[model samples]
Target: MSAVDVSLRRGEREILHGVDFAVRTGEIVALVGPNGAGKSTLLAAMSGDHPISGGRVEIDGRPLDRWSPIALARRRAVLPQQHSVGFPFTARQVVRMGRAAWARTPRQDDDDRIVAEALTTCDVEHLAERPFPSLSGGERARVALARVLAQDTETLLLDEPTAAMDLGHQEEIMQVVRARADDGHAVVVVLHDLGLAAAYADRICVLEQGHLVADGAPDDVLGEELLGRVYRYPVTIGRHPETDTALVLPRRPSRASSPSAQP
Candidate 1:
């Protein structure tokens, strides 16, 4: 999937301004920025859930509007930031819902196997029997992700997939994403955690107030000056001692200088 010069406006205000982005097979692209930076809006636009006032979204060189809803669902799947259901649906039922796009098609035959695998892959096999509403925040997040995985599309668009998870689950989710990318699927994830993005993303796109400021490898784009300016805080880049990934941390004031630490 690709977007060229994409722009979005809402109720007299422009949210995104000519942002150019694309994700290819075997690649993991991360979108990172502060609150209201248009990350979720951009992802929604990509998935055809939101309207774009200017520019176009394309899949396989064809405009997004040209494809039927089911046809597009077969090619790409989107996992939105919120997953809510009015009915009492079990986690397994929810995951199986992902295969609805192929209901009458030949691929429908594989629904059982695919849903089972998705549940297992997301580490939600145990929760599969429980009502989705009864699951914890982290468990619900994983089940939602399994639904997306079961969609079995070439490209996956995720919005804050780990926002509710613990440290271990966050790493596990990113690892699953990494495996997906390695298996030749395109992955685009919106992440508030810069450290997580820097650790797993092949490329990072930085947005500040809806404008695309930088797009490149994490090491190139996540510098002290740019991050500090965009996030409005002092940051220092360091290396992880174990994984050796780029580590982004706030440059906090010293104890003697900190307001909270004053004697």
Candidate 2:
């Protein structure tokens, strides 16, 4: 998916200004910035869920508005920040819903196997029979991801997919995303964890105050000065000893002392 000169507005309020972004097949692009940055809005605009006041979103060299809803669903799947199920449904059922977009098509024949694979891939197989509403936040997040995976689209747009997970699961989820990208899927994920972005994203786009400030490889884009300025906080960037990934941390004294830091 690609967006050119995209601008988003809401009730006379401009949220994004002339953002240009594109994700090629088999690549992962991460959107990163401080709170209220236009990352999510840009993603939504790319997905056609949010209207753009200017510019266009294109898929396969065609304008997004030109595609039918089902055709669009077949090309790209979106995982928003929140996961919710109004009805009482099992995890597997929630995933099956992903295939609804393929109903009446030949792809529907693969629904069962794909759903199972998605459940296992997201590590939600054990919870497949559990009620979605009954699962923990992280579990629900995984199930939600499974649903998106089951959709089986080439382009995946995810928003803060690890926000509710523990460290291990966070890494595991990104690993899934990385593997997906390696398998020729296009992925765009919004992430607050610069370390995760640095570790897994092929490129990181840094946004600040509704503008695209930087867009490039993690190593090229995640400099200490740029991050500190965009995040409006002191930060330091280093290389991870084991993985050689960027290690970003707030520049604060180890014992510096806030009541919030106290257990």
Candidate 3:
């Protein structure tokens, strides 16, 4: 999927400012930035959920608006920042909804098998029979991801998928995301956790004030200097001792000198 010079507006307010981005198949691009930097807005535009006032979004070289809704659903799936189910739907039932796009097709017959596989892949098989509303936040997050995976689309746009998940679950979710990209899927995810982005993202796009400021490999784009400047806090970037993945941490502020010690 590619977004060229994309600009989105709501009334007189502009959310995204001519942002240009593309993610090739088999790539995982993490969008990282301070809050309100337009990361989610960009994802919404690329997913065709929000209209663009200028520029264009294309999938397979065709404009997003030109593709039929059902046809486009088969090529891309979006997991937004907030996922809600109003009814008392079980996890299995919720995931089965992902197959709605295939209704009336021969593939519809495979919905059961696909939903089960998606549940297991997302580590939510054990929660299959549980009511979605009864699950914890982390459990709900995993179930939501299972629903997305069941769609089985080639391109995925995820918005802060790890939100409300525990540390172990967060890592597990990111591992699942990376595995999908490795399987030749194009994955673009919004991430507030710089450490997680550094660890799992093949590429990082840094946005600041609705502008794409930096884009490159994780190590190159997530340098301590750049992070301190963008995030407005001292940070240190290091390599994990065992896996050698990028590790990011905030530096503690130094204590101010006492009046007696001052010159």
Judged by lDDT relative to the true structure, which candidate is superior, 2 or 3?
A: 2
Q: For candidate 1, lDDT tens digit of each residue in 1-263?
A: 99999999999999999999999999999999999999999999999999899999999999999999989999999999888878889999999999999899999999999999999999999999899999998899999999999999999999999999999999999999999999999999999998899999999999999999999999999899999999999999999899888899999778889888787
Candidate 1's C-alpha runs over 4 A off are 259-263
TM-score for each of the candidates: 0.97, 0.96, 0.94
- Report the lDDT tens digits of candidate 3 across residue range 17-97: 899999999999999999988999999999999999999999999999999999999999999888788999999999998
Once superposed on the true structure, which residue ranges of model 3 sit more than 4 Å away at CA?
A: 254-263
Residue pairs in candidate 3 whose N, alpha carbon or C atoms collide under 3 angstroms: none
Candidate 2: regions farther than 4 A off: 256-263
Global Cα RMSD, each model:
1.1, 2.3, 2.7
lDDT minimum window of 10 residues, candidate 2: 252-261
